[model samples]
Target: MNMREKTTKAENTPADKVEIAVRLDSELLEQIQHLTNDPSKVIEVAIRQWLRGEILRDDELTRTPVRTPVPPRGEWND
Candidate 1:
């Protein structure tokens, strides 16, 4: 079918050691399980990809600085 269909079908199989929750039609799940044989891996990979995107999307990482404010000139004569 389409890429999504292919991916979905390929994401339900069992791999090494990992657990993930996915909601889909039974038929779709079965199809995916048959193809991927590791649902957890599929979900893990997807989540990691999404998180990476989000991390990169937040461009404020380098723009914000945390430091104590400098006292006003009038108060700092010492």
Candidate 2:
């Protein structure tokens, strides 16, 4: 089997999902491994949650009104 086949054979992965490697600190990897046998699931969930928050923040920023600076009180100069 080729590299793609090996990576894409992860359990519970969708057919459309393809694997891409990511580098993580050994300490972080150990912690993740302790939490669950399937690190991919944890990473995927974390990414989804982060993306959702980012999207909401973007939407709020787009909807927020832009503040216009008020001109200093003075006689109008032609």
Highest lDDT against the true fold, candidate: 2
Residue pairs of candidate 1 with colliding backbone atoms? 9-32, 13-37, 13-38, 13-39, 14-37, 14-38
Writing each residue's lDDT as its tens digit, candidate 2 over 4-75 gives 566535555677787879999999999999999989888988898898874356667778698988777784
User: Candidate 1's residue-wise lDDT over 5-44, tens digit each?
Assistant: 6654326645644444557788877876886986666666
Number of colliding residue pairs in each model: 6, 0
Query: So what's the TM-score on candidate 2?
Result: 0.52
Q: lDDT of each prediction vs. the true structure? A: 0.66, 0.79
Q: Which stretches of candidate 1 lie over 4 Å from their true place?
A: 1-22, 54-78
* lDDT of model number 2: 0.79
TM-scores vs. true structure, each candidate = 0.33, 0.52
